[model samples]
Target chain A: MLFEVTADPLHPQPLIDHVRKDESGAVAVFLGVVRDNSRGRRVLHLEYDAYPEMATSVMRGIAEDAMERWPLTDVAIQHRTGRLEIGETSLLIAVSSPHRAEAFAACHHLVDRFKESVPIWKKEVWEGGEVWIEGEPVERS
Target chain B: MKARVRLFARLADLAGTRETEVELGEGLSAADAFRLLCQRFPELADHSDSVMYAVNAEYVNSDHSLRDGDELALIPPVSGGDRAV
Candidate 1:
């Protein structure tokens, strides 16, 4: 139950440690890194924006749903906002279960649902232009 | 009544600001408030189909009624987590 949305850089180790349990025989983790290229653009940076209050609340809900849908022993999710450098981790998803199948499925499920509904956004800046990845067309101000 | 409208992403860029205050008639729905926004920022109307409504940080239906002093967020098509392409 360690869901959060923050503006600080994210690390996977602490989140992985949070979900580890002696009873759990398996652990699954996913990291969404800020890659350097997108849609044929050259290497650059990215900016993530989120409605922090609602984003965290929605993340918690997604984690709860993942727990209910799978035999998960623990769940944790974190998303970073604001400026992010290349190779930085923007998202960390971890889940623990008694078996590998459940852990894997739940971790994947969290990522899918979190992406589909979370009130967060990714802005891709590469070369001479930038765009809000999924929102609108490219136009620099 | 007055309701504060919050914009994000492209909508914010179109509006030239992230938030604004709008006057709403009694019993008017959040969707109606958006219509008012369109009157001020017609460019936003271009995205009417993809917009989503959030009241006080919680997702709600467009038809959801608004009250005085409510905070309504106009969520554009959220750039989902996947940036790999």
Candidate 2:
């Protein structure tokens, strides 16, 4: 129940704390950090944007799907937007379950779903130029 | 009917603005509206084959009919990077 899309910084503590349950024994966390380089470009900074409402709704759907597939105690996710520097946390996901295996698998699934389908965007600004990381041909197809 | 078109990322950059108002015929689908948008902006034709259409925050197909006041967003391939949580 921790689905969110925000411009503020992200922390796993709240999400981890959220899934703490008496019955849950494992809490798996997936942290997405802004790296210094992408596709060989020395990224100076990154800008993230999202259709907040839609993004959060999609996050909820992803969590729901994970819950249905795994014996999850709970799942939470948050994606940060706006300017982010190298090494900053950009996405955080926490999944708690009865055991370690389910927690890990669910956490991985949630991240993949968000990265592939959410209506969020990333703009990588390097020294000379910047471009949106749309994962396809940059020029007109 | 009229709809609010929202652009994002490279699409927004190519259109030279993020949001614009579009007027369309009664029975035109989202695909038709998209064609019209590219007619006005021209640059958006670059993504014609790949654009994903969303109306009112829910993804829909090209043949989906549009309505007044609907918010139509054209999504490119979402490649949200590994950034802040």
Candidate 3:
């Protein structure tokens, strides 16, 4: 498993390649990109920041949870921090399994859980001002 | 006991510093420490309801107990792109 929180744009292809193996017949990748609009506002860009230690720990927990829930051969999650422009890749998730169904399921679950759990925050810089969005604390099962 | 309190994003900007060492009475709960912090930084009082607390890198409620040398992070609102799923 590989997990990272950095300012660099995430390249999903490398992550997909790394998880591909002879025993693994399927790989699923998910990419999250920065959009130009949010809540009716024209967003110029986004600035992401995180409590690194907490974010990483939460991510690791998410990965562990994914592993337990699915028969995944490998998993990689990368979330970008700092300034990001529209169309820039913000996050990437890759999961590999012996079959396509499991790989897709695990990859989707991993990304959803990560978003709901991770401590990384995004600041939407609109044409007029900016707003900070935080995740609601959900009970971890 | 002395605990380190770290602020992130908007909270850090409001506090004007990233981290501070706070000395609390014995057996301080997360709530108590937060109240003391709010007293020191009045601006935080306005957003206390929205702020979230993390103890030792894990999100916790105000009722959570504090330990000596614990790392406390005050998380303000997150302003990132759509959550990846």
Better of 1 and 2 by DockQ: 2
Indicate the worst ten consecutive residues by lDDT in candidate 2 chain A.
A132-141
Clashing pairs in 2: A89-B84, A89-B85, A90-B83, A90-B84, A90-B85, A91-B84, A91-B85, A92-B85
Query: Each model's C-alpha lDDT?
Result: 0.84, 0.86, 0.81
- State each candidate's clash count: 0, 8, 7
Q: Write the per-residue lDDT of candidate 1 for residues A20-128, one digit (tens) a residue.
A: 9988899899998877776667758888878877888888888888888998999988988888899888888899999999999998888877777788888888888
Encode model 2's per-residue lDDT on B1-85: one tens digit a residue.
6999998888888999889978979787888988999989999998988788889998888889998889999888787746233
Provide candidate 2's TM-score on chain A. Answer: 0.94
Poorest stretch of ten by lDDT in candidate 3 chain A = A132-141
Which regions of candidate 3 deviate over 4 angstroms?
A139-141, B77-81
Instruction: Report the C-alpha lDDT of model 3 over B1-85, residue by residue, as the tens digit.
Output: 7999998777777778889978978788887888899888887777777777789998888778888899988877543337632
* TM-score list, all predictions: 0.92, 0.94, 0.91
Candidates sorted by lDDT, best first? 2, 1, 3
lDDT of 2 by residue, A22-75 (tens): 899999998889888877779999998788888888889889999999999999
Candidate 2, residue A47: Cα displacement in angstroms equals: 0.7
Tell me the lDDT of model 1 at B84: 49
TM-score of chain A of each: 0.92, 0.94, 0.93
Encode model 3's per-residue lDDT on A15-91: one tens digit a residue: 99888888899999888898888777888998888887777787788888888988888888888999999999888
The number of clashing residue pairs in model 3 is: 7
Candidate 3's displacement at residue B28, Å, is: 0.6
